[model samples]
Target chain A: MSDFIEKFSSISLNDIKNVPESDFPELTAEEKALASQAVTYSNRIEDADSISNLNDSLRNKTFIVGNKPSKADLLVFEKVFKVASKWSSVEDVSKHRHIIRWVDLIQNTLVNVPESEKLKVSLDIEVPREIKE
Target chain B: MVVTLTVAAKAPLVPYGSLIATEFVNRSNGDGKIDLQVVDQKSVDSADANSASKLTTSDGKEIKGEADVLKELGKLFPDVLQEVSKSQDLIDTAQNNLSIKNFKELATHLEKLDAHLNFRSFMLFHKCTVADIAVWGVLRANALMGSIIKNEVYVNVSRWYNFLAADERFDAAIQNFTKSLAELKKSEKLSKGKKESHKA
Candidate 1:
């Protein structure tokens, strides 16, 4: 099954509809629209302003929803990471400090050595260039 | 004055209606002058109907559409009347500017809203006004703009959107919408099943 369907299979429809917590409210209608927009927008074109705006908004934030990395934060992190990676001329992520901090915290601190090490093999990812140097 | 608003749960304008009702209730704060009743049309209609979106006054005058209902509320209350009009204008501009075909126009409108929201927490000076309600409602209702807010595409606008969204009143309103929509969908599925059985 699709990633979406697999996720859906685990949750009840009632669970799907309700924004059950103080954490991330179930994706509101607007969030759904934004998701569609984000997917479509990314498929067709890249918007640098979107990346910059996300980075600007995250200036003081530790995570997207809370201090810890939630699924919402990870989803946003992945999307913004895609945009940040596309900035051709920037030698490193110095300009996008918030994003780098978030990604590092998730990969190095949140995920344990084995998991991150496995991710490294699959993703072939290095510490963000700034952190590496 | 008791004002009951009947709103279609699936309508794109539903969020605005909910926000208006929530804001009105908050502003009233059990003063007993303004008793706001919000009715979901999903229970009454087999299918969602925009015409069911109306506001009935205590005197029994039915007002229709987001603009009309908001306008009447402004007339009756007169407290946030100017703010209501300003909010509607901002909503109109934001709604009009959302276009997949025209990225430049969308960016321009986004920047304009971002700048407008830069220093202001609410659309108005300090308090959350109808302008914030209408714009946030409309933006949230729009799928693309909703994503923009969800993703925090514009820093100031995202900050402001998150603030209003965090309001318990807003959360309650959204919960009601979610329940009503789910119920409507369930009913729709059952009805479809009945039809299929009859055909079989």
Candidate 2:
């Protein structure tokens, strides 16, 4: 079970690195097409600048929804932190007040396991390089 | 306003929550749209499980239990379930609760369940409806667990996962989530190996 959860955690992280236009690998035909469509859809709803701003604003709080913490934050936090750390562009955008507050909330309140233990579990796993393009 | 289903941190429903939201939204036909909101349920203090249980939908609808949702979705979207069952290896790799020998049996049952989904004249609606999204979430979580175990048998499942990952909307929301998980583990490993080297 721990193995499964650990692996799940790793896969989630890998997915963050696979996003379009993050200096990650170029998208395959399908990914590119899908990404283009999403960009269009997102654009139709709101501009990139606004979306970026929204993300920045949302980052600082300890909770993403409701008066208390929820699972959605756990799933999203791991990825947001990774993206913010790995990509300079993402980091720049994530440095907004909301994002910082949210991250701080997660860091201070949400984290249940010891940081060292988490780091240890993460270190034990091996990441495969050959993710399908 | 769009109706969204946000998950709490450490909630068991996190894996399948978005898929369920997608299914609900797809089926709502824009009537009562279901937007997926992934919350950090883990932030809720451990002692607050009872309080967490009381959390409701944006409109105050209580989220259904996992089993109930799965059964309902299974009845609604049989075809998607069939597609998911086709990736047997992926199913086998998700968790150790099930034995390896049960893979074939599970696959067989999944096929039957798929058939049930496809049974058009059986009074249920046709096509991939919101119910399919529910089942899809379960299958997807199982496959995710399998992939992490490095189960080689799940190659076909991997193929299917890649196909889903290629989609922009799905990717936009889920890609970051999965990738961060993978990296967190990797960074831990690198740091640990370094520590061991110093100790040596």
Candidate 3:
């Protein structure tokens, strides 16, 4: 099982879609690697420890990879966005505030899609975890 | 003319959106001429406009996609299609709301549709065009639409929906779909639909 999991993870990393030049002109290597990483997020998001790593990675960042939206953002968006609406409550959502933020941003900024197509995250209800004195 | 629409040979035939567009055209027209053939889903997608166009008057005019099938059905009834096509956005909006599982958002969307129906008897035109058939058909298919309209939240949408449902053909279309659908074990037909009784 361990061997299978290891091999599976590596295989998923190579599942990244090449962002067409028309979508976002020549992506630097950093963006390309980030896009590849998006493919393995399904695993990362499930592991409690790895999920925190994702949350921390997204703290100050907007997109998952490069500052400009690219295939990486969309790949992660594909994994996370679908389940975001069913997070149960604000507690589950507020725990991943940064992830939620990135998901919402990708939906709106990544593509000039229609309003109905966009996934909405009501950030207002997610109150501060603790008001720092 | 024997109108035939092709969809993939998938199970638990969820008839909404473009998937059921041909059925909508066939049943609403009461012509019973349309034949929904189950072929390889790949062949339907590979059928380009070049080939599909040439198939205009025959036993096998390949429909590129369900939406293309919709446009073909539209061509058969120009005036009805024109009006109903305008209100297709309502179908899309309601579908989105349902997807997110946001009842609040759905009510707001329904309010807008309700407002539209407030002034006019139908969606875009004076008569029940494909617009009424399409919108009403989808909402009836949804499980939650029952309670949402139970108290009649949006009187206009409820009124319009029931008004359209009163047509026996609309009811029959649903009955036919449900009876056929019952044969297949429910796959991930509609995640939203899974929680409720699949009877609808």
Q: Considering only chain B, report the TM-score of model 2.
A: 0.42
Best by TM-score: 1
Residue-level lDDT tens digits of model 1 in A12-126: 2123234232333356555555444444433432556665555554543444542222344434544454455443333344455555444444444322223333221112122
Residue B166, candidate 1: C-alpha displacement in angstroms: 0.9
Better of 1 and 3 by DockQ: 1
Selected candidate, larger lDDT, 1 vs 2 = 1
- Minimum summed lDDT over a 10-residue window in model 3 chain B is located at B48-57
Give each model a TM-score: 0.50, 0.32, 0.42
**Regions more than 4 Å wrong, model 1:** A1-133, B12-20, B23-28, B31-52, B78-82, B85-88, B94-104, B194-200
The window of 10 residues in a row where model 3 chain A has the poorest summed lDDT is: A1-10
Q: Considering TM-score, which of the candidate structures 1 and 2 is the better prediction for this target?
A: 1
lDDT of 3 by residue, A11-99 (tens): 12234455443444356787677656655765566677656667666643445653344556656666666566666576776677667
Candidate 2, residue A109: the lDDT equals 36
Candidate 1 structure quality by residue, lDDT tens digits, B68-175: 666566666655334665566764564456433355667677776765543233465435556666676666666667666666667657766776666655666677
Q: Once all C-alphas are superposed, what RMSD does model 2 give against the true structure?
A: 22.8
Candidate number with the higher DockQ (1 or 2):
1
Q: Which candidate number maximizes DockQ?
A: 1
Residue B101 lDDT (model 3): 39
What's the lDDT for all of these models? 0.50, 0.37, 0.51
Please give, for residues A18-112, the per-residue lDDT of candidate 2 as tens digits.
Answer: 43333223345654543344334333323446445434323222134322233444545554454433323433322333343344334433344
